[model samples]
Each structure stands twice: as structure tokens, then as C-alpha cells.
Target: MTEHLGTDGKNHLQRLASLRRPLAAIALCCSVAVSLQGCVEMMVGGAVMGSLAATDRRTFGAQTEDKTIVFKGESRVSKLIGEAGHVNVNSFNRKVLLTGEVRDEAMKAAVEREINAIENVASVVNELEIAGVSSFSSRSNDTLITGKVKAAFVDAKDLFANSIKVVTERGNVYLMGLVTQTEGARAAEVTRNVGGVQKVIKVFDYITEDELRQLSTTQDKQTAR
Candidate 1:
């Protein structure tokens, strides 16, 4: 009788362990969904995020460094600007983009100068407008436009959607990517068509078609793995 009870206990534990795996997976999906903030972007970006390390034009090391640069640069810039200036900092492949409004030309120049001094920053594009800080509604609209631009890219079969990072500020759209001239032009053209986009700035690290082909292979290998 004791032996029979031990066998049943083991079976019960095995079943519980089996249940935990699926439960854990569901929990993880929920966590990612919540963290991504937009279910649609998350769904659309799922493929991109999965293959980000593989398919990125920047090498894995460059991608990590770019993220680090953005984190440190944003912290420093936000502190420097205070409430006087509304600044948004974006770092892609070590190049920093400064948008939003500053008090004057001095504040604008200062934002660039400060970010430029950061280590590993290749360059700073200061597109900070001199007008008054934008209202909440304006910024919200910019967010909507950014989502639309990204969704448009996902549907744009001619271009790789994940290759570009889209930023919209005050009706102007800025694109950052490591792509070829053709890809950049294609991306800009797509953005220009998005409603409420006033201007497009291409900040691209142009590569040859051969280089692009080499990068494309990475995704295949990643998938096979």
C-alpha cells in the first residue's frame, strides 16, 4: 500500500511540473505584452524583436553600445534641460538625435554640446526647435504618428521594417537606420506619405548591397538555430 502511494505521489508531482511549463510561458507572454505597451506594435514587432540581434544592420556589439549610449545620454540631457526645455534624445548606432523645443538657440546648442561630449557618441543631430515647449496633446499626436509610420513599414514589403527607428516631433519625422541609399529613400518616401508628417530627415549609415546581403544571411542562420 505504501509503495502504491509513493508511485501516485510521483505521478502527481510530474503532472504539476508539466503544468508549470505552460503556465510559465503564458506568464511570460503576458509580461512581454504589458511591457511592450502597445499590443499591435508588439504583435507587429514580435518578429523584429525576435530577430533583432540577428537581422540588425549594426553588429550585436554595436547594438548594445547604442542602447547604452541612449540610456546615459537621455539621463544627462533630461537633467540638463530641466523644465525649461522639452528635449527628446534618441541614439542609434551611436549617433544621437535631439528633438523637441528649447528656450532659445543657446539651450539648443547646449543640448547638442552636452550630448556630443558623451563617450561613444559618433555625432549629434540637433533638430531642437526654438518654439515653446509642445503641449501634451501635440506630443500624444506625435506618438500616434510614430506608430502609424512603423505600421506602414511593416506593410511595406519592399523595405525591412525593423531596420529603421522612427521619431516624430511637432509634425516632423526623423528616421535613423543603418541601410543602403535605396532603403533610406524608400523609407523616407513612406514616411512622407504618413499624415501629419511635416518633414523627413534621413540619418542613415549607408552600406553596399553586398554588405546588406551578408547581413540578411544572419537572420536565416538565426532561424535555423
Candidate 2:
């Protein structure tokens, strides 16, 4: 009877051990499922964040910036001028470019002083001519010239057309860009050829050929690494 009891005890222990193995397996499976769910949630959250960031990033080119602020600034600039003077306000990315003719140096200084006080202005490029009031014909012709220059930049094969910003006021063409010297010069030449352009002023941040090559090399190395 004792030997029979020992056999029964062994059988019970073996059954308990078998049950523990299945239970352990089930626990492991549950853990894996929870881990996978967490990973999926993290991935979905990242995708949503990435989409939102992309949507928020500003797109360059043909962006008609809100002219209300610019117009208001222009009006304020005009108010600062003498009766004989004119103020031209051209705003891009919050940087205000002031160009036109004022009656005297005082008027010019006052115009700049007034514009400097305006809110949201990043910086001011005061290129106002003090002596001469620009003729209507001259201004009209400058407009035509600007259109032509813009057309040329847009048609260029080697340059990024949208990256070049053309601002013309009173026969002076202001060129803004993040480009190589060669590209900037080419763009300037194109502007010069446009009819009635009195002068071309460069406000470019130039990227040299060697630096551009180095930048390209670095990018390639990063990609390879």
C-alpha cells in the first residue's frame, strides 16, 4: 500500500510540473503580445507626429505673404515722409526692403526710423534715394523689367527658380538667394538684361564651389555610413 501511494505521489508531481510549463508558456505569450501592442502604439504616434510636422513646415515659392502687414507698414512709412517723398515697402519673410525716393536726408532717415519701429520686422534694408522722385514711366518700365528677369530665372535650367527672390522698386532690382556665386552672378546678369533695370543689388548668402563640394561629400559619407 505504501509503494502504491508513492507511485500516486510521483504521478501528481509530474502533472503539476506539466501544468507549470503550459502556464509559463502562456505568460510568455502574453508578455510578447503586450510588447507588440506597445510597439505598435509608439509607431502610430511617431507617424502622426511626423505628419503634423510636415504639415506645419513652410513651403517656399509663389507664397503670397499676407500683404496687410506690409501695406500697413508702407502706409506708416508714407506718413513719415515729407509731402514730396515716396516710400516703397517690400516685405519677404519679415525682412522689409525700403526703396524709393525721399525729398531730403531727413525724410529718408525718418522713413527708416518709422519702419524700424514696426512690429514683426526682422531687419530693414534702406536703399531709398534722397534726391530724385522716380518717374511714373520709370516705375512702370521697372515693373516690366522685373517681370522679364523673373521669367529668365524661372526658365534657367541649372538653378532653382523658386529659391531666387526678385524684388524691384524704383528701377533697382534686389536679388535674394541662397546660392553659389556662379548662380547669383548668372541671376544678376539676367536681371541686368531686362529693360529699364537701373541697377541690381545682391543680398545673397553665397555658397562657394569648394564649400558646396565639401557639403556634397559630407552628405554622401553620412548616407554611406
Candidate 3:
């Protein structure tokens, strides 16, 4: 006989199912890479990375700079808070988003200040809550929710999944990317409907339809080469 699942168990299983599609796609990519001949490995690797860079709206230089900002920002925040609070730093196109928790408003402001000082950080969005550190179980749930939202984006064939970045803290979903106004709105609508999403916050840098068309053209040219 099959065992029955409680409401929580059912929800957990559903979340797992939501994540399976993207994970499976990744696995398939890995399998294909492994099956390729060693002679073509470098070519295939370059192609994959090129495809990803094309899909992202930021210039290649900006992408590298964003990585540097996140790494440095995280280190600075850690030194300041140091076991006293939780912090997550995400950088996109030189703009930083700060989430997680801090003990007081003072620390929250301090964290934002430090992030702003990081080289190449154009601006900072301070979403750090003034509360005690979140428990591990809560954080795990947040991770699951983030994955589900990403899967939902991938399932939405209308959107370019790589164009948007999803971040979850507690139950709130934060989306950051460079997208057209219509794309940003549609992404928020899709994310709002996902399970366990209490709220959806859009941090998108909007572009004109003409700008989007230009980006598409540029990406197509890069992909062709």
C-alpha cells in the first residue's frame, strides 16, 4: 500500500516537481557534453559560454564587473556583520541588491553604505530586514522557492529565462534584470502565481521596445559567429 502525504508533504513534492524540468535540461546538456569527442571539447565549451553571454543583456565586461562586485561586497558585509546577521549580495549591471537580515536599522544602513562603496557598484537597493537571522529551515524553503520560480520562467516559452534573475528571501521573490517593460510585467505576473511566493518585487532595468529589438539583433549576430 502507498503511504499518504500530509499537506506539507504534498507541497514539498510539488516544489520538487517544479524544479525537475530545469534540472533535467541541465543534466541533458551535461550528458551531451560528455558524449562529444575530446577534440571538440574546447569548441563546445566556448560555444556554451558564448550562448550564455549572448542571452544575458549585460555586456561581457559588465558581467565580469558584477561578479567582482558581488564577491567584494559579500566579503565586506561579512566583516561588518560577522555572525551577527545574515546577508546576501547580488549584483546586476553594477547595481546591487541587499537582502537577508540585520539586527537593527543602523546595521542595515551600514551594510548598504558599504555595498555602495564597492568599485563599479552604480547603486544599491537596501532590502535587508531589521530582524533576527532567519533559521536554516526558512532559508532552505527560500532556496526551493527560488528554484521553482526559475523553473516557471523556463516553462514560460514566451520569456528568455536567462534574461531575468530570481532571488528569494523568506517568501518574497525578487526579480532583477534588463528587460522591456512588457517582459518585466509578465515575469512578475508569472512569479506571483508560483507556490509559496508571498510577494513579487521587480527590480528590473526597463528598456524600450526598440532597444530590445536592437539587443536581439546584436545577440543574433554574435550567435551566428
TM-score of 1: 0.76
lDDT of 3 by residue, 1-225 (tens): 115878888888889999999999999998887877664988889889888889999988999999999999999999999999999999998989999999999999999999988888899999999999999999999999999999999999999999999999999999999999999999999999999999999998999999999999998998898
Residue 97 alpha-carbon offset, candidate 1, angstroms: 0.7
| Cα lDDT computed for each candidate against the true fold | 0.86, 0.73, 0.93
Which candidate wins on TM-score?
3
Per-residue error (Å), model 3, residue 8:
77
The alpha-carbon deviation from the true structure for residue 205 of candidate 3, after best TM-score superposition, in angstroms, is 0.3
Superpose all Cα atoms of candidate 1 onto the true structure and report the RMSD in Å to 1 decimal.
8.8
Candidate 2 displacement at residue 42 in angstroms: 38
Q: Is candidate 2 or candidate 3 better by lDDT?
A: 3
lDDT of 2 by residue, 1-225 (tens): 436668779888889999999999999999999999999999999988655433221222212342554777778876666468767787655567778888888887888778777766667888888777778887887778778887887677766665676878877899875578898888888878877788999877577788666755754554455
lDDT of 2: 0.73
Model 1 residue 207 lDDT?
Answer: 87
Report the lDDT of model 2 for residue 98.
79
Ranking by lDDT: 3, 1, 2
Candidate 1 lDDT over 16-91, as tens digits, reads 9999999999999999988877877778798677766565677777788888888887788789888998888888
Alpha-carbon shift of residue 204 in model 2 (angstroms): 2.8
Residue pairs with backbone atoms closer than 3 Å in model 1 (clashes):
none
TM per candidate comes to 0.76, 0.58, 0.81
